[model samples]
Target: MTPEDHGTEALSGWGRTMRRVCEVRRPDFDGSLLDAVLGAPRLTVRGAGKSYGDAALPVNGVGAVLDLTAFDRIVSFDEGNGVVVVEGGAVLKDVIDQTLPIGWKLPVVPGTERITIGGAIASDVHGKNHPGAGSFGHHVLWIALLRSDGAIVQLSAIQDADGFWATIGGMGLTGVILRAAIQLQRVDTGWMIRNRRRTRSLDETIAAMRAGGTRQELDPERHVVAWLDAHTHGASLGRGIVDEYYAASTLDLPGAVAPFPETRSPGSRRRRSLPGPGVVTGATIAAASAARWHLSRSANSQLVTMRSALCPLDRADGWPAAFGRSGLVQYQFAVPPNEVGTIHEVLAYLGTHGLTPALATLKNLGLGTAGPLSFPIPGWTLAVDLPARLLRPGIMHPIDKLVAGAGGRVYLAKDAVTDPELFPLMYPRWPAWRRTRHRLDPAGRWTSGLAERLGLLS
Candidate 1:
């Protein structure tokens, strides 16, 4: 079991925060995977590096960062049953390209399709349709996990449920995700019928979500989300646009599942990369926010590709660069149905500090997941992206306490700075998840920067 030395390299997640220098290694397929996991002194598995924080990084700037992109492969697909077997490193976009041609798509996907299947499972990512589709883990039929003891085991909801759920949102602390068999959903086209509604206030935005049903009941067919303008104040505070979508098949002629178009959307050619810090400011954000609101207000119903409807940020590519060198911190928290005030309080806190969030969205999350560490619960969730420079310890800490007190939890995938002391309160199931994670890797061989910071590695 020998490993190759790729030398030391600097690594960070999508947010470009907490950059760490770590020894790096890339193992080839089959026998090489086992050798890589067993031969390394200590390491963390990284896939596409799409997580917003340190979950993919090495702790304390030491250890090997295992690059698994080479393991990407679509092993096979059972079109009859809508199940596809893919390597852990397989990207979601690739899966969609191949499977969609045959009338199948990933049952659940995150905002960015560039993320790897392995990352999705490790994070248990959710989408705009979370209330109906749940998180990525719910769609996984089984995972082939490489444990710390050098054993490969198969896990599923029914078989080895403890190991399975633990690995779902365990932040790669349990073991290496070798691959997985995923259940796909059928789609007739690659497009969605989108409708936009302008909301006057935060209350109206949430009421639109409840319009589908009760505050808790979200219509499965209609994918819903809202874009908020944090710059507005007084009567206009929380003014935003709400978007509702139905699959193209619901209104258009049903046909073979189509692939994402090769041609880019108009104005996408003008997209630019983030050059450095100080590019994003309150003034720039306000202008952009106003432009977005006015543009949506003019359109009521339109035909948009699933890519446009689901992952609009993908078009901007390196848009986060606008946040400058300090990058950005995305604080996404979810609360129960009755605790709606938490949203108002947090937003008002940001407004009072004059730190306008550059980007914000609100959605209704449905069922709580079986994975103990999974973030979503049945209620409303709001995610705000603020420039790292503008956010101080004084601000985030209070928001943390507010969220924890409201019986809510932050999304570990998007979190970079939450006091470890507040973790247990936010995620009460941590003890159970930790126990299962320990049983899978009793030596605590699988750990990351996030695991260590949040005291998940004991």
Candidate 2:
């Protein structure tokens, strides 16, 4: 569809809170319109409107939201070598559907598949195998960037290295990502052979996860994500299981599907028919409730192949409806490697303080990216989803202080409660990032809620 077809008027995202600075412009695959926006008074790029927080929201609505969805295309794919190049607006689900049938898969993916490649790179998203694969940016070979000065720049580790590092996880403040070449991993089959082991204590769960990380042959697709009963106390604290897996070859199986089956729809049929904020919220809540119930049951755990275990979110229609009307906020933070024990302590505190999140997931990240405000580090990261109603001062504020004290910082892409003062403490590279950003965007034309809250703009 053309820009005018979707309406030239400004549009908000799925969150509906970040209104555009100027009229939304949907440019075709070429870089001409993007170049114009870069030279305009102010500009920012947006895709899919799936970002949980405000990373894609233009600051002050002064510039325009350069809608890149129109640029979607898979430029090339080499199944034998497992490398694919695509435009920035290509959705993760789209890539997976095309690649998985050929025994290839994205190296990493976030919880949701509705996100665009540009959005994923802007957030530098990670997945269950982050301890091994690192963030998505690590797998990227090069990117086509529309620079602040209206120049189309091709950046890689060796070419334009400085700009490349600055743009990855730069929250798209530096420029618009036009296209990217990513390296995909080879898998034996579309199915995952999974192992589910239940642990009675947080310590046991941690030990199991650490042990699982050492087994290279297993190449697990999922990890330890827990469902802690807030009402449970003391000895029963942090009781959960770790689910690990490896891709299983389906060559010997009869009538095995070449590509994986689509994910089951998360919301009800009636709910799917409805539209607007109210219906979306209700659907999200219902989905979350079902997921929580499923996880809570201690059923027979056995081995399952990759396709069954690592289902992409978008494949399951109506999945977005699970968060309900108030919507869900994913609060993730990383503490020092030595301070992971502190995460358990914080969980205990949350249980006692009546702030236990609905869902809690943990991962071990390798190192921090060079982005001025990147979130990962050589530490353990925990992500939790909480209802917006729980964001009151009495609850979230103290939790923020606790995380800060532990040398932890919230993920900006998932954050809605982070206090501005903690930005410098969590991200030591902020000053350097700001320096690079000023050099590229001296007028600070590009901005977002994250930038504004963290004082990233001068």
Candidate 3:
């Protein structure tokens, strides 16, 4: 061979929050891959890079990033048990396409489809139906991890409880997850029976959501979420639309030349990135938020696929351009029931600043796994995508304090900016998590930009 050609490139997550110049290594899945990368002084694992924040990017712009994209292979599938074992780098979209046709889907899927199984497990993401379904970690059966000392081992909640929980939401610091076996949720159809209701104010929205599912008796597993109009304030501070969904019962079309599933969401097939930053101004954001409120009628006429219903903005096609190069701050935080008013205060703060929030999604969350750094808990969770420029000390810092005071925690997977000092307070389990991480990688070789920023290594 003439030579093994290698190239260096600046990498950033989907949100474009931070760019880091580093050496990227795409190693074939092999026995020696662990020894090769562990030789490097510092290393971090990256998959899909769809996290939209610093969690995937390493700090200090040094060390090699072991890109896990190439290792995406469906290793095994046991249809009888509804369990599938795959490599960590496997793309979730591919898994969905393969399993959906067979009446199975991921128990917990985040806002986007372009994520890796490793990334999902690392983040321990929550889905729209979190109150009923819990988080991504709940469905994971086991994982194969490679340690710094070149020892590879299989970890599961039962056999290796500490190592298992540590790696689940460990943010890739515990070790490099080589593969995992995850249980998939069974579904009868691919379509969603969509229902939309209008809430006049924030309190009404909260009440409706607290009722669970829909005003009308609906399935317990109904996927319900809300969209808040950031421009509305004062008496109208909580005005938004509450959408409730369930997998539509399978149906045969009257004019069907070919057989089709009961719920066909053509949206999952569509994928588009930003052509450019485009015209995303304060005025446009306000108009969009208003449009969502007005466009969704109180009636239950909307019908959509699972993909479309799960992430409407992703279906917008080229929507990420609105945030542009600065990438949006996917500021997500969860506060317990006592601090529910924190949402009102934060919304008021946004309204006063005249910063029309983008993609303001609200969902009632359930308790998380024993994973020390897991994000969700038994409470209401709000994920707001704000313009990166507006993430200044005055705005971001106060919100951080608001959450920290409520004994809440921010989502590391989606956070671009959060105080390091408050991190320990937000995640009280971090002290234990750090202990487990050190035990796994005693050399402190597995580290990332997010790890350093949030003082994960500290």
Candidate 4:
């Protein structure tokens, strides 16, 4: 082990709001990574750097970072059991491209397919089917973790149970995840049967979603999600389209087994940047929202490709960068069924404050994972993207208080400016996660800006 410094570089989250300068080491060899872990004083492991906040950045805006992009690889696959072993740095898109053609896909996935396997586990990301399939951690079978003491240990729900669950959503503070084995869901085809409806108000939307899944049903694995028009106010507040779909059971649909949507190669597409800072203003969002709402109507059941169903936004190249250099902030929070009122409160606040988001999505999450740091809890979750320039300092403070009071917690993966004092209140199980993290790395070698800000580091 050697205490050598790598070149320093500036980094930011997907939101492009939080920026930091840190020493980064991109070790292509496994031995070099081990040495860096054993020698670096304060370090954090970075994956694809897709987290909307500072979860991948170093502590206090400075420290050593282990870049694992070159470490990406699909180790093996078992067609019999639909299990695939992949390096932590492997992107989900690549995995989908490899497996989807063979009639298998990840059991659960987030909004974007560009993130790394390590990132999916660290965030315990949930998708539209969260009402049934749960989050990413639920699909993980085992993990190879590199601890601060330089020992590479295998973890599972049964083996080193505490470490396994903690690292699931511990935001990489537990240690550096080298690789993991995940279970894949079987699909006869790459097409989905979509059942969409336009809700008239917030109550109607909630009723439609609750009446749908998130509980027992003929097709328990059905995916359900809602798109909200944030520009609406008063009676129209929360009016949006609710969609529920399941994989096509038959191969009769058009393009039922179409080749995997070719993911964009790096630098292959030119992005159209926003012309001005206020290009995404309230007026613009209102017009766009209305157009989208009116245009969403279609047959109750229609056939669409999996890629179009799961990650529709991928079609727009560099959409985030379109928010201008200041980037955007994605605020996502979850609340139990009884506390559904919190959603209305937040939406009302946004309306009163005139903060219209470009995109807002809502879903019903089933029971959460045993991982103490996991974000979902059997309830309603809403996510909205707001341009950084549109926000005022402390604007989110009241929303945080409301969520915590309702016994809900914000998603740390997309959170950039959550109040440290309120984090524990929202996540009451923080102490348990902290204890497990400390047990894994007592020297506190693994730390990130998110951990430091939210007091996750011991």
Candidate 5:
């Protein structure tokens, strides 16, 4: 049955692309899901609906959309070795809640806690400590993939190496990921010891970041993320605060402390009450356009704990509602190690051109995996969030050109406005990835807005 045949409304995403490409089916079990996918004209996988753009949207004229939320589960966990195997649809927040109490945590997490493990793997997402730990894909031990031909294969570094790499950041074009084995890190406590420093300009901010990052002992975790005042100019341009965190040693733990709270399943009623489109839009724009002066003032204040500074969204009820109706777009890109200075240049350009992104952050990234389409590079990366209202014609095109000119490339998972022409330049491995997909999905059954826009599918 068509998606409309089921009386479902048009399926879209945070990017606001309104289109009906296929019938969507939510399957709880992998076996049934695989059967449906294998029998479909084509298929694409989706999780949590967290993608900021049309990357998760089915391509026009083919395929069914497989929503994996029903498959969410924490299949297994090993507290001793900090290894957690979870279903592809399990939310990061759920994983964190289960593990954090035992003095363990996911090695890497994106800004939002609501994202699914599959989405994290698909995006190869990086976080505050990217310079040290790299992308989430790096810690992945294995993945169970359902190939287009209906075969289930478990891939890892030493086994099915190429497929493992491709699927890590392949944007679900390689296959439908069934589950993943992830490595977690040990922590003394659920708390984070943080340090916050305010810099005067872009140069100082970079220097401060470099300085903080080098201090392995002081900030052992090396969770360094900066908040740039995109509207600042001249001497104050790129002015922002750097927040760093380090895991506390067990011996150094406080004399009196509370243990991590118990894991509680959110009620079905609460989940059903998630804010609708209009609410999402209002919250995101308000948060994005609020007075920068006050924000800077608050960020300049003293450092706080993990609960206070990092992952603050976890504290609020229905935190996802913060994004508002149009939802949120997290635009991230990376530049080569030698070209780190360009980050400042880009920030300055944003400020001067009155294109100040509402939120701007910088992180250092390590070498990437063998994924033909993975986004990581051995360099520094920056992530920014923009309200949809600011996507004026005159503004976005020039910004896209600027990033491309600086030898930087946008993160496909987080992008909604990148130019189709710039795709090949950003991903030199695109041709190889396309070749591999051809072998698996010869008929081009799996497609997305990104695949079509970037010529990944015909």
Candidate 6:
């Protein structure tokens, strides 16, 4: 089997902060190529590298990095059963473009369609609609995992419950995910009716999210979230805009199974580029937030396509590059509804340190996922992206103390820094997850920089 071997290249995840020189392996679509890589002394699977942190990155003491983009293929789509079987590396964008026109959409569409099926499963990614849709894994029917010892294992809740949940958010440590059968959502025009409003205070923000969070059925079309202003203080600590979305009215309604008669969706027209780090400072963020609030008056109850509704953030290309050389660290954590005070404290803490998160966001998550390593829980989740310079130890310590004390958990997928000592406290299922990891990979062949930092491989 031939291989596209880009020998010893510098590799990094989307953050572009941590770069490592490593052997890169790209496998072709044919069957034998994957087996060849599995036989390597050590290696880790990487897809799109859309993960904000090191979950998909291979660094020190790691093995060759498998660039799996070439393995992308939509093997089959069974509209009759609403299930699509896809190759592990099949990107969400490709899947959406192909399926949306045919009246189906990903049940759990993440913020960016650039994610790959393997990466989505490894991270157990949740979406704006997670409160009702749960997560990407919740809609996954089955996975074809290639174990370290050259065994192709098929897993499902009933087939291999232990391996199944472990692999869901197991951070690719369980095995190399080869393929998956996932359920798709039915859509008419891939369009939504959105409601936008400006909120003044933390309470107002929470109330708006709660009021807008009413669900229709299995889908969370009522995706409620707050686009917050991190530079604000005092009376307007969490002041921002809350946007809620619902199915478009019946006047132009395409029934769930009806063919999409119009174009799939138009892309965002936001600025495509920005000066790195210093250019996107606290002051800039404040201005941007305020501008959005004012413009929101004109944005209310507008019809938007699925792409516009689900991933407005991706409208701009190379946005993260705006963080410059300092890179970007997105600190995303979840705290129970009762401890929302922690959310306030986290924002207050960031402000106290004179750091303004370029973008701060809030969302209400659903009940905990079945996967032990899954990040979502019944709570309020806040995510903020800060320049790497502001991601100092002092800033994280106070936030960690508040979150852990409140029984809140950090999302491993978006994490760049967290004291390893505190991880077990955040994820009580660590022991069980570790045991399952050992069962699937006794030698711990499947690993990444995150596993090493979290002490999961130890």
Best by lDDT: 4
lDDT of 5 by residue, 271-343 (tens): 2223453344434433553454346542332323444445643444343334444444667888876776577
| RMSD (Å) per prediction | 2.9, 4.3, 3.1, 2.4, 4.2, 3.0
| Candidate 4 weakest lDDT stretch, 10 residues | 261-270
For candidate 6, the per-residue lDDT at 312 reads 65
Could you give candidate 2's per-residue lDDT for residues 277-311 as a string of tens digits?
33333344346545554465443334453534554
Tens-digit lDDT string for candidate 3 (293-328): 887678684656777777554555455556665656
The global C-alpha lDDT for each of the candidates, from Candidate 1 onward, is 0.82, 0.67, 0.78, 0.84, 0.70, 0.79
Cα deviation of 370 in candidate 4 (Å)? 0.5
Report the lDDT of model 3 for residue 18.
Answer: 81
lDDT of 1: 0.82
Query: Clashes per prediction?
Result: 2, 21, 4, 0, 6, 2
lDDT for 284 in candidate 5 is 47
What TM-score, to 2 decimals, does candidate 5 have? 0.85
lDDT of 6 by residue, 175-276 (tens): 878899999977656668787888888888988877665552355666777898777789888888888787664465535533344544345332322444
How high a TM-score does candidate 3 get?
0.92
Which is the winner by TM-score between candidate 3 and candidate 5?
A: 3
Give TM-scores for every candidate, taking all chains together and pairing residue i with residue i: 0.94, 0.84, 0.92, 0.94, 0.85, 0.93
Model 6 Cα shift for residue 25 (angstroms): 0.8
Candidate 3: residue 386 Cα off by (Å):
1.1
Q: What's the distance in Å from true for residue 448, model 1?
A: 1.1
Cα lDDT of model 1 by residue, 1-458, tens digit: 14874678877778876789888888877687777777776889899888889999998756788889998999999889998999999888888878866667786767778889999999998888888888899899999998887888999988999999999988888888888999898887777778788988888877887664342244444578888888888767788988888777644734443444443433422223255666788788889988877676735558778767777767766666777777888999999989988988888999898778989899888886799998889888899998888776767888999999999999999989888999999988899998898889955567788888888765
What is the Cα-based lDDT of residue 241 in candidate 4?
94
Candidate 3 residue pairs that clash: 58-449, 59-449, 191-263, 202-238
- Ordering by TM-score: 4, 1, 6, 3, 5, 2
Clashing pairs in 5: 42-63, 277-325, 280-324, 280-325, 281-324, 281-325
Any runs in candidate 3 off by more than 4 Å, and if so which?
1-5, 213-220, 251-278
Candidate 5 worst ten-residue window by lDDT: 265-274
Runs of candidate 6 with Cα error greater than 4 angstroms are: 1-6, 30-32, 216-219, 249-278
